[model samples]
Structures are given as structure tokens and as C-alpha cells.
Target: VTQRLCNQIAGKLNSRPRKRLGFFTPQEYIHAHL
Candidate 1:
């Protein structure tokens, strides 16, 4: 895969809410912690 594709995938994954995080996206969780 190209670098651009990898970034797109990462962005999508990070923007998705996970049940383990109380339905918060990864980005939201990181910002809250930081």
C-alpha cells in the first residue's frame, strides 16, 4: 500500500468509536487523556 493509503486507513480507524473506550473515538480518548 502507498503512504497515502496507510494514512487514510489510520484516520478511519482512529475516527471510529470503540466499545472499550466507552464509545469514544481513539482521537477523542487521546485528547481527553492528554
Candidate 2:
């Protein structure tokens, strides 16, 4: 159970950065388009 919880936390931590990066890229793209 502890291992599973740890893995879930790790997965969220990893994906959080990726999600932020994706949002940033789109915002940059819109700025460039404008």
C-alpha cells in the first residue's frame, strides 16, 4: 500500500511539470501568433 501511494505521488509529480510545460507552450504560441 505504501509503495502504491508512493508511485502515485511520483507519477503526479512527474506529470505536473509536463502539464505546466504544455500550458506554457500554448500560451507562447498564442503570443507569437498575435
The number of the candidate with the highest lDDT is 1
Top-scoring candidate (TM-score): 1
Candidate 2 segments exceeding 4 Å error:
18-34
How much does each candidate deviate from the true structure in C-alpha RMSD? 1.1, 7.8
Q: Which stretches of candidate 1 lie over 4 Å from their true place?
A: none
Computed on alpha carbons, the lDDT of every model, listed in order, comes to: 0.94, 0.62
Give the Å error, residue 8, model 1: 0.1
- Per-residue CA lDDT of model 1 for 1-34, tens digit only, reads 8999999999999899999999999888999999
Candidate 1 pairs with clashing backbones: none
- Candidate 2, residues 1-34, lDDT tens digits: the string is 6999999987766544335456445545556678
Candidate 1 — worst ten consecutive residues by lDDT sum? 22-31
